[model samples]
Target: MGNWDHLVGASWRGECWAGARAELPLLLGVLPFGLVYGVLGLQAGLPGWAVVLMSSIVFGGSSQVVFAQLWGAGVPAPVIVGTVGVVNLRHALYSASVAQLLAELPLRWKLLLAYLLTDEAYMAAVGRLTSGPRSAVRHWFLFGTGFTLWAGWQLSTLGGVLLGATIPAGWALDFSIALTFIALLVPSLRRRSECVAAAVAGAVALLAQGVPYKLWILLAALAGMLAGMLAQALQRGKSHE
Candidate 1:
């Protein structure tokens, strides 16, 4: 019995390590973005500790940037909270999608995974979950991936904060955030429905750019989701016929 238990533990650790290794490539894109956020947060007049604390607590890159930008610009606190809430609405969808796989997990485990769920982590985890045979200990895999990303984000943010003091304003590091998002987005347009959705979202965002409180982003996201769902339904109908 002892030997059997030891083997099981070893297998679990191996899976965790495999997950961490698999997530390393995604970190390449994430690291620079973290650095950019740290620098931007500092440049926006956020204290170094506050910037780092937000990265630790918030952990959402785009939303954090928006928060720092808006807060720096003297936006009211309630509006800042609302904007962050709207921006992170997609996490609800993410939670729903993965809820079944994680259903049996303890509440503590569920909470930890939920907190660690980010775009990069979700992309990596879902691909693993769907494309292969399910493992009994797959949650550990998620923990491994999430924890790896969490560490990377913290370290890179620290690096950025340290360097932010000396970095020149002329370097234009902020544009890199958009480019990073584009890189992440382009690869996910694998299906016709997804492509249409992305196109619609882009159009709506562009047309609604002047909307106050960054509401255009929320509108664009909703429009894209609806477009994608409609396209998928049409495809399903055609397939059944």
Candidate 2:
């Protein structure tokens, strides 16, 4: 959130279309996620409408799955809300990382971007965002990426709603989520600090596996960040020596 001085009137349609195109590969994994969620929601006795609507309302992917899982288990609404909120706190880091790129946008654009900044969408847009100098046109790029993902989510959830249990559980499309993340994460762990962070986080996650509501993800993420920071600090110290 910055002042309006840097705001430019220019917007690029080409960048937006390109961004949408770029996001297509990521959706391959994301579509099955919605399908799995949809099937699980139905099996949980969530009304079809609720399952479909959750995609738009919660839109937080894993958090939504946690919500449905807890809901099915008859968890209290307050507890569900709290747990989901805790899980979603990772987005705070995402916002912090991308804040500068979007700082110049007006309130409406900021709000839209905030809503659209899901995990896959953010990954899709971030490269373009940091690839070069900031341009208002890049906002459209994010819009394209985020909107494509959003639409994919909605449509896939709908597909799941319509398909129901007709799809075999054995197909195990859920694995795609892990595969997608691996695709995103492995390439980025090029530095020693990143590798250290990832290793520490993975260990913490396995150690915290029993924690409910997928809270281990948040714990792992925090540990990874701290480890990465410490690694960077030690590296710098050694270099200075």
User: lDDT per residue, candidate 1, 86-164, as tens digits?
Assistant: 7788788888998988899999999999999988888777765555456678787777788899999999999999999
Poorest stretch of ten by lDDT in candidate 2: 1-10
Q: In model 1, where do residues sit more than 4 Å from their true spots?
A: 1-10, 169-172
Task: Give the runs in model 2 whose Cα sits over 4 Å from its true position.
Answer: 1-11, 167-188, 191-241
Task: Estimate TM-scores for all models.
Answer: 0.86, 0.75
What is the Cα-based TM-score of model 1? 0.86
* Model 2: residue 81 alpha-carbon error in angstroms: 2.5
Residue 79, model 1: Cα distance from true site in angstroms: 3.1
Model 1 Cα shift for residue 170 (angstroms): 5.6
Clashing pairs in 2: none
For residues 1-241, could you state the per-residue lDDT of candidate 2 as single tens digits? 1122322343587667766887899898789888778877776679999999999988987787777767876877777787788668768767888898888889999888889888888788777776644575778878889999999999999988888768664455445555655665797677899899889988998899788765675677678879988999999999999
